[model samples]
Target: MQPVRPAERRHETVARLLREEILRGTYRPGERLPIERELSRHFDVSRSVIRQALLILDQQGLVRVRSGVGGGPFVAQDTMPAALAAFENTLAVDPSSVAEFAWAKCILEPAINAVAAETISDEQIAALETNVEASRAALERGESAVDHLIDFHSILVNSTRNRFLAIIVELMSRSMDRLTGTAGIRHLDGAHVLEEHEAIMDALRRRDADEVRALSRDHLTGIWREELGTD
Candidate 1:
C-alpha cells in the first residue's frame, strides 16, 4: 500500500478523533466545535489541515459548516440518520462499495448470529418467526421480500444486544439498500431469500450456533453473489 503523506495523515487522524468524540457525545447537538486556529494549534497542524478535518466531519453530518462573524462548525442535531443521508448523497457509495458492503454483511452476520444464537430471548426468536412468516406471505403474493429480509437480519443483529455492532450493521445495510434501490437492482429471488430466512430462524430457535453461523454466511453470500455477478 502507498504511504500516507504527513499532512493528509494528520488531517485524517484529527478528523477521526473529532468524529469519534462527537459520536460519543463529547459535543452535543448545536454545540460549535473549536475554532479553526484553535484546533490547528491543538493538533499541532496547519489551519488548512484543521479546515480539511472539519470539512470531512461536515460531509459525514457530524457537523455543519457556517460562515460569517458568528458561523463555524456545529455538531449535528441528529447524527445517525443525517450521516446515512450524507453518505447516500456523496458519490462515494457506488456499485463497487455496494458489493463490498454486501461482503461485509457476509462477514458480520455470521458472528452476529453466533452471538444471537447464544443470547437471544424467546420473544426475539418469535419476533423473527413473525418476520419469516411475513416474508413467506410476501413471496406468495409475488411481492419483493428484500424489505422483510433486511428487517429479519436487523432483528437478528439487535438480538445480540451489542449497540456498536448493531449500529455498524444498520448503517451498512441501509447504505447497501439505498444503492441497490438507486441502481434498480430489484430482481432478488424472493422464494430463495424466504427459504433461507426461515432456515436461519429455525437455526436460531434451536440455539444452534454453528448452524446459525453457517446459515448467516450462506445467506449473505447469496446476496453479494447476486450483486457481484458471481452466482
Candidate 2:
C-alpha cells in the first residue's frame, strides 16, 4: 500500500489522539479543554490544525466549542442523542441497510441476555421492572410504547454493564425504530410481552445463566418471526 500523505496523516493522528483521550476519560464530560494555543503547543501544530481537529471532535459530539469569555471546547455530556442522530442519518442515505441491521439485532440481543445473567445486579433488575411497569401503563393508555420498549431493551443491555454490548443494543434500538416506522408496526400491549421480559428477568434473578440465555433467545426469535416474518 502507498504511504499516507502528510495532511491526511496529520488529520488521522489528531483524530486518533483525541478519540483515545476521550475514551480514556482524560477529558471528562462538561470539562473544557485547553485553549487552541495550548493544544497547538502541546501537539506541535498550528492553531489552524488544532481548530480542524476540534471541529472533527465536535462533529462526533465528543466536544463542543462555545464563543465568549471563558469559552473553549468542552466535552459533550449527552452523546447518545448525537450518536442516534448520526445512525439515523446514515440509514436515511441507505434505507435498504435497515433490514440487514434488524436481522443482525435479532441474532445479537438474545445473546446479550447471557451476559446480563452473569453481571446483572438487584438495582438493575428493579430498574427493568420499573420500565416494564411504565410500558404496561403506556399500553393501557393507548399510547405508543415504542419509547418504553426501547427503554426496556436499553436497561437490559445496561444491566450487563458491558460498554460494547450497550453500543450494539443502542444501534439495534435505532434500527428497530426505523424498521417499525417504515412497516407501520404500532406499539402493542405489553400484557403478553411483559411475561416474556419477566421470564428473562426472573432467570437473571435466579442467577440461571443458561435459562436466561435460552429464554431470551426464544423470546426474540418468536417476536421477530411474528413481526418481521423472519425465522
Candidate 3:
C-alpha cells in the first residue's frame, strides 16, 4: 500500500482540488458531484477524508452536502452570498474600511444609475415609484423606513440588468449593512431619503440619463459624506 498521508493534509488537498474544479466550471453550479465513495476512490483517500474535505468546501460555500435518498455534494447555486459574507467579515475587523467602501459606492453607483436610466423598463420605474411611496407613507405614519430605503438601491441595481454589477453592488450593500446596523453612525433621515429617491426616480422615468447621473451622484455624495463625516 502507498504510504498514508495525514488525514488533515489529505482532506485539505482534496478540498483544494475540488474547489478549483468547481470554480473552473468542471462542476457547474447546482450540479451534483460524485458520491462520497466515488470521490474517495477517485482521490485515493478514505470516505472520512472525503467527508472532511466536503465539510471544508461547504464552510467556504463552494459546495453543499445533502443527506438521505438524494444525498451527496453539489456545487453552490449562488456563491454571491458567501462572497459577501466573507467581505463583511473582513470589513468588520477593520471598521475604517467602511469609509473606503463608501467612496467606492459613491464613484460606481452613479455610473450604474446612468446606465440603468438608458435601459430601464417602465415596470422598473413603477417599482422604484412604489418603493419611494412606501417610504413616504411609512415616514408619514411615524415609522422607520430605513429598510425600505435600503432596498431601493437593490431595486435600482436590478433595473440595470447586469448580473456582475448586481453582485458587486450586493457585496457593497452587505458590507454597509454590517458597518451600519439599523441605527448606527449614519442614520439617514426618512424624509430626506424619500426626496432623493423621488428625484432619481423622476429622472429615470424621463429616461434622462444625464439627469439621473447627476441626481444619483448628489444623493450618494450626501450619504457617503455624512457616513464618513467628510466634505
Candidate 4:
C-alpha cells in the first residue's frame, strides 16, 4: 500500500477525534466547536490539518461551519451520513463499463421503486410530481433533462429511507450518467424519457408496487438500450 501523506494522516486522526466527541454528545448541536488553533494544539496537528478535519466533518453532515464572529463549526441538526464516499469511488470506474452500469441499473432501480411503493409517503409523491413537471418543461425545451431524470430516480430511491439502497442506486445512476455523457449520449430522447417518468409517477401515486417495478426497469432499458441502440 502507498504511504499516506502527513496531512492525510493528521486529518483522519483529527476528524476521528472530533467525530467521536460530536457523536458522544460532548459537543451538542448548535454549540460551537473549539477554535482551530485550540484544536490544532490539542491534537498536536497543524491548523491546516484541523481545518481539513472540520471540512470532512461538514461533508459528513455532522457539523455546520459558520462565518464571522462567534462563528465556527457547529454540530448540525441532521447527523446521519451515508456511505457516499463509496458511491464516488464507484463512479470513478473506466468509461467502457457504462454498459455494465446500465445493466446493473435495470436490476436495481426497479427494486427501489418496489420499495418506494411500500414506504413512500404522500409528501414524497408530491415532490415526484414536481420533478415530473420539471422534466416536462425540459422536454418542451428540447433538452434531455437527464439531471431532472436523475433527480426523479434519486427521490424515488431516497423515499425508501434505506440509506444503503439509496447509495447503491445513486452509484449506478451517477456512473451511467458520467459514462453516457462521455459517450455523447447526452442528447437522449427527452420526450420519451418524460413520458416514461410520468407513467412511473402515476403508478407510484396509485401505490402499485408491481407496476412501479416493471415500469422503472422498462424505463431504464428503453432509454439506455432501445433509444440509441448503443452501449
> Which candidate number maximizes lDDT?
3
Q: How many clashing residue pairs, candidate 4?
A: 0
Off by over 4 Å in 3: 1-13, 24-28, 67-71, 183-186
| Candidate 2, superposed: residue stretches over 4 Å from native | 1-26, 40-46, 126-149, 182-186, 225-231
Worst 10 residues of 3 by lDDT: 177-186
Among these predictions, the greatest TM-score belongs to: 3
Measured against the true structure, the TM-scores of the candidates, in listed sequence, are 0.67, 0.72, 0.83, 0.60
lDDT of 4: 0.76
**Overall lDDT per candidate, in order of appearance:** 0.78, 0.75, 0.83, 0.76
Residue range 13-122, candidate 1, lDDT tens digits: 88888987887888899999988887877777888888888888877778888899899889988668875786566626454565556776689769878999998999
- Please report, as a residue range, the 10-residue window in candidate 1 with the lowest summed lDDT: 179-188
Error of 4 at 115 (Å): 1.1
What is the model-wide C-alpha lDDT for candidate 3? 0.83
Q: Give the TM-score of candidate 3.
A: 0.83
Better model by lDDT, 3 or 4? 3
Ranking by TM-score: 3, 2, 1, 4
Candidate 2 achieves a global lDDT of: 0.75
Deviation in Å, model 4, residue 212 alpha carbon: 1.6
Q: What tens digits encode model 3's per-residue C-alpha lDDT throughout 38-69?
A: 88888899999889989999989889998888
